[model samples]
Target: MKRSVIPREFFCRYTPEVASDLVGCRLVRVIRGRRISGIVVETEAYRGPKDPASHAYRGKTSRNGVMFGPPGHAYVYFTMGMHFCLNVTTEPTGTPGAVLLRAIEPEEGIAVMVKNRGPIAVDRLASGPGNLTKALGIGKELDGEDLVMSDRIFLEHGRMAREIGTSPRVGVSAGRSTRWRFFERGNRFVSRGRPSSPQNP
Candidate 1:
């Protein structure tokens, strides 16, 4: 498949707006000579210091400094000491904000994803953040990488999601009342099933 990368300016918008708009867009990863791709299906927004659920809420640190960098960069981070999750920086430089790429519908390189995840059902190949990263071979090494120009991984233009659902973010202890999670409604590949509300036409 051809890759038409999204430009840097696209991510300079508000975190939640970017997160909602990301659904159905293509995330591509080029590993060696192979191409692995998927359609983004679910995302959660983090709005810098004011949002308690955000890693940058407490303030910037060596681990989270990337969140303060310019938009359109990868913010891959380790979670639970066992899994990696992928996020894209949002807003502008000096302001920390991001969108967590929660789920994806695998589009290419199924064999590699299956090999990495081991005999999982096809629908669940990249159904969650950790799983998505594993499927695409994304890890800490790609942290702070520019997604707009990175040869390893980048986002491409895909059809915008027509029906979008919003809800309180999952797996976060704080900011539980904030409806920052966005996903494609009725998409079986979405990371979670319950939609607290509907947003976008």
Candidate 2:
């Protein structure tokens, strides 16, 4: 199938609801001589200030300042002393809210993903936050870069992805009352289901 690249206009138009609804879209990253694409199997939503699950809750800092920038940008960050996670800036410029890409099922460029991720089963690679970023070669350098024009990464319009499911976000202490995260049900690529809420569905 031809890649369904998302246009900058569509990306810029995204709201927190739209971002949350992007769970099953395909995420594609063009690497050295390879095009790695995957069905975005999981996602999380963070509303600024009001949503305790958001990084902007602490207000914009040197690390999270990019969240204050324009939409269609990448927001990569490190955590757990060794892992790097990825997020996409949402809402308009100066407004802070984001959609966290939680998981993806490896589709194209399995060999490339394997090369970046070291030895792992094809299905296991790019299955979690850290692994997905590693497999796609995403790092702090791409942190504030615009995904709409980035030569290496961009989002595609996978209309079928709307069939995706929703649950509360993972590893969050706040915003535990509402269901905000999204994922593809039954897809092994879904990262561990340690949600902030008591239920998974």
| Best prediction by TM-score | 1
- In model 2, what lDDT does residue 6 have? 68
> Which consecutive 10 residues in model 1 have the weakest lDDT in total?
192-201
Model 1 per-residue lDDT tens digits across residues 87-177: 9999989999999999998888999999989998989999989889988888899999999989899999878786988888888889998
- Tens-digit lDDT string for candidate 2 (103-184): 8888898888888899988777987788889888888878887887787888886647535666767788999886787776
Query: For every model shown, what is its TM-score relative to the native structure?
Result: 0.93, 0.88
RMSD for each model, in Å, please? 2.8, 2.7
Identify the candidate with maximal lDDT: 1
Candidate 2: segments with Cα more than 4 A from true spot:
1-3, 12-15, 195-200
What lDDT would each prediction earn against the true structure? Answer: 0.90, 0.77
Give the per-residue Cα lDDT of candidate 2 at 162. Answer: 35
